[model samples]
Target: MKSITFLTAMTVAIAATGAEAKTRLLVNCFWPSSHFACSTVLPNWVEEVERVTEGRVTGIIPPKSVAPPPEQLAAIERGIADVAVMFNGFFGDAAVGPKVAMQPFVGSHDAEAMSKALWATNREYFADEIEQVHLLSQFVISPAELYSQTDTPINSLDDLAGRKMWVLPGPLAEITKKLGTGVVSGPAVQSNEIISRGVVDGHLGLDPQAVQAFQLMPYTKSTTKFSGAIYSTSFSVFANKDKWAEISPEDQEAIMSVSGEVLGAAFGRAWNEAAAMAEAAYADAGIEVVDVDPAFETALQEASAFVTEGWLKAAEAAGIDGQGALDFYKSQIGEMTN
Candidate 1:
């Protein structure tokens, strides 16, 4: 009887020990090593998860880790990594359906408003389009501005006409075409090479850190600020479906609690600070900054209608209620901006 009791006790102890082992997740980021989205915001997410789960869940980040930014969603779906951060524009080829968020001039310049709108849109309509993975949170960067290699300046819509411009393809590309500029499509990391080799006369999708990260400052001569931001990209955190299912319910809830607006606010603060840093760097390098005149701003606004119409068409082709989503997004943006 004593031997049997000891065996039972040992089995229980071993089982308890196994249950106490930490759950580990691998997070993949496509941003460069120095980008704040990778170095600052993602680390904060890992810390928050561990803190909330009381160390039952831990994350591992492999350095210089990334798949092609557009391929990140597919990677997560395939379990290439337990978690990944991906951009909406990267999936343009997949017919992943209309991501209205990528359409130029759709949202406010403030990340908070854009992030909230994205989150709400996902909850209301985008779940099926992104159903392959478990979504954690969605966000938008500040609107992209135009950067140029000449001090010639772009004050009106007509200024962009006949210029060779590098832009990410999709609605933005279509808009550029409508404006009569030749558009070159590719990733941000390749911008320096493209510009240096004269593949493009200028670039349209300039973010402060992105320009800095790719070392494009030496090639750029001017920065143009529009009346409103021209374009912005949407991003989200995703986990492999199987991996997400394996997490304990308690830990899952803990993670979800900190994901949406909370994560967006944190990311916005980080991005805003990084933008400031980039501005300082540009100033120190003697790069010229140009703000658009009110007359040109109105012309750019008229040109934006083409991009918005393109989004509506794409959304309809994908069978999504494009008008409904757009209206809701606008409403949310107004509320958040206020």
Candidate 2:
């Protein structure tokens, strides 16, 4: 028994050494190193990939991102980074899978379930729409709600009017614009500076995790939530095409075997847990949480009409089953959450 144990440990050490010798794929992460994406999601993913492959592959994140948040995809595609995370919405109408995932009221606050649904939807109906890169995993992060730092709270649809709001680009921006708010488009990472400088009166899509991650509690004092998710943020992990091609097919399968929906579900669960923490933080900060009436929901659906139509139009242009994809995604979420 002692001899057998020694041999097994030796074999494991040899495998680890072999994997450690392979060219470590550089993972360019745009989020702060303290942020969960850098600290948890990406790191955990790297470990999982290496472990599942029995140390046949490995990866690492640089000290900082090689490019800005919006330019991550371009950097990876250009081979400036081997693997990277990207906000799908950064590509606008060109990124249909993300647009589909961000559609209003399509998901609930269960980030894990929503993420799994998004992966399933992408695999079945929207993969071709975003196959421009070698996709490793696809995901979304919230059932986002409204947050404010000013005197006027966003309790009603009309309250949204004329407020200069910092919003993420993509369908959420269009949807907010239709509600009569002026939008300042930027990524969530910049929200602290924008809100502090008074660049925008409030932000439109502040999720609980975001509020906590960015220290938004000091700036924001009120919250408005919809019964269902107002909107969600889309993300993807992808490899540079050439870099992906360099991996042996066997290793590719080993890498992919533990990615996609399984990894996406992890992000969902992590975000959801972080959101719970934010809620506790909100309570300590005296942030007033408000739930809108049914009337507000009616007005929201009417106000945001073009967002879905725009997605479908873009989908048709890309030959994707736009409505079908939407239905499939929602159904998957429903199944998982239920």
Worst 10 residues of 1 by lDDT: 89-98
Please provide, for model 2 over 75-190, each residue's C-alpha lDDT reduced to its tens digit, 9 standing for 90 to 100: 98888999888877777666776567788888899989988888898888877665567888888897677887786678777777768888876667888887778898876777
| Worst 10-residue lDDT window, candidate 2 | 16-25
- Candidate lDDT values, in order: 0.77, 0.82
**What lDDT does candidate 1 reach at residue 175?**
75
Backbone clash count, each prediction separately: 0, 0
Model 2 residue 320 distance off true place after TM-score fit, in angstroms = 0.4
Segments in model 2 whose C-alpha atoms lie over 4 Å from true places: 1-23, 197-201
Scored by Cα lDDT, where does model 1 land? 0.77
- What does candidate 1's lDDT look like per residue over 4-93, in tens digits? 999999999998976666678899977776677788888889999999988888888878765777688877887778899877666664
